[model samples]
Target: MTRIFNFSPGPAALPEPVLKQAQQELLNFRGLGVSVMEISHRGKEFMDVAEQAEADFRDLLQLPDNYHVFFMQGGASLQFSMVPLNLLGEKSTADYLNTGNWSTAAIKEARRLCDVNVVASSEDTNFDRIPALDTWKLSKDAAYLHITGNETIGGVEFHEYPDLGTTPLVSDMSSTLLSRPLDVEKFGVIYAGAQKNLGPAGMTIVVVRDDLVGLARANTPRLLDYQVYADSGSMANTPPTFAWYLCGLVFKWIKSLGGLTAMAEINSRKAKKLYAAIDESNYFTCPVAEADRSWMNIPFTLADAGRDGEFLELAKARGLLNLKGHRSVGGMRASIYNAVPEAAVDALIEFLREFEKREA
Candidate 1:
């Protein structure tokens, strides 16, 4: 069977090694004669898997003991509400930075729960760049400052984080989480959906500071409360056992590759290579500001937009799939997540040159 390169924005590509290992053990995991998906999440074997995944995650990030990691079921979209619900403790306003679609969606959700103070936004430029950090007008009495580390659709990323001092900082890092090393101590909370860099789509990883655990509003549902998951090892109810197991394998895979530092170097090179091809070619154009361009997702357009369909059809014929951009924003987007190989980027670059040469 032939496998094509996949560049989906979500439910993206995964490591072939991880897939093979899972396949070998799919039906009789640890000789239990049952698929890992059929096993009890609370059983001893699955518990061990859960523990080791968290440990490996902490090790890769060098997380401080003060933070608690929870492998919850809802994706980052749910966190848009959960963040304000749990963190808004007596305060009426929460500061937010609107970088792109995700951050804008977060702000829209937050306004429903409380007063949302938009500290700054780059919407004026159609999210081509992040607003300058010095221009942010932080609120003194804000509950927490929320940011999206990367925008999957618009292809903008925050290369540097803000220091909020006493105010809590929350981030939705669905596309950026495992791509590189992070300064965990600077934020009060970090959450990401597993689809991009971690594993599959069923699970969401949430890391919260100890102090922020019990701050959910009184009316918050147990399922929506961070404290509930923290209290029960993220097993307050049945968890996503199979997704958790796969993510654990991904964590091990990352560790084997020298952790986040190695991933960062490789990711940087991959992004830069593609960007250079785009920059040098008069046939292609990437609207994102150079400084804020995402290392994981690169969006670009042809000089003649009419040929987009031809480009996608040709790329598909070449076994380079999912090069289509998000619907809200039109163009081609190549999401080079952690599991995507460097060769795939090289292949894409080669195709770019070939297509441009033939069609330009």
Candidate 2:
């Protein structure tokens, strides 16, 4: 079977090795008679798988002892509600950076739970850039400061994280997590939906500092409470076993390739190549600012809107799939997550060149 290069934003692509390994083990996981999906989450076999996945992830991040990792259900959208429901102890407001679609969604959810103070926003710029750090109107007493590490749809990212003294820094790193090494100690909370850089669509990986737990308001649902996951090791409910197992395989794959440091080097090279191609070509244009461009997601527009359909159809014919941009922002987007290899980027760059030549 042949695999085409995929660029969908979420439920993106999985490493071929990981997929093959899962396929081999699907019928009878590691000599067990039943599929991992049918096994009990609390059973020793699945428990071991869950524990090792967290351990490898911690090793990848060099996570500190003070932080607890939980594999929860859904994507980071659940964390949008959980973050404010839990972190906003007695504070009336939380600070948020409005970068793009995910950031706006998080801010809207927080507003329902507490007063949301937008620290900075790039709305006036049509979300083409990150609001300069100096322009942020921060609150010293805010519960926590929130930022989307990367904007999947808009293709903007915070290349450098903000330094907030005393206040906890929170991030929705769904699109950027595990793409490179991160300073785990710099933030009180980090949550990632397990589709882009992780394994699958059904699980989310949440890393929260010890202090951030046990503070959910009395009215918060038990399942929505971070404390419950922490207390029960994310087995308070039946977890997504297959997704968790696949995530473990992915973590191992990353480790086998020499961990996040190596992964970062490869990802940087891939993104640099693609961005350089976009910048050098008059036939294409990247809408985001140079400094704020995302290494994981690259959105570019053809010279005109009329060529979009031809561009997409030709791309598909040439084995490049899902290059269509989000409907909100019309154009083309390429989500080069961890599973996407440098060769894919090279292929994309070559396609862009040929397509532009044909248009010219």
RMSD of each: 0.7, 0.8
Error of 2 at 322 (Å): 0.3
Tell me the tens digit of each residue's lDDT in model 2 across 1-360.
799999889899999999999889889887998889988998999999999999999999999899999999968999999999899988899999999999999999988988889989999999999999999999878999999999999999877887888899999999999999999888999999999999999999999999999988898899999999999999999999899999999999999999999999999999999999999999999999999999999999989999999999998998899999999999999999999988889999999999888878
Best by lDDT: 1
Model 1, residue 49: C-alpha shift (Å): 0.7
Full-model lDDT for every candidate: 0.94, 0.93
Q: What does the lDDT read for residue 180 in candidate 2? A: 93
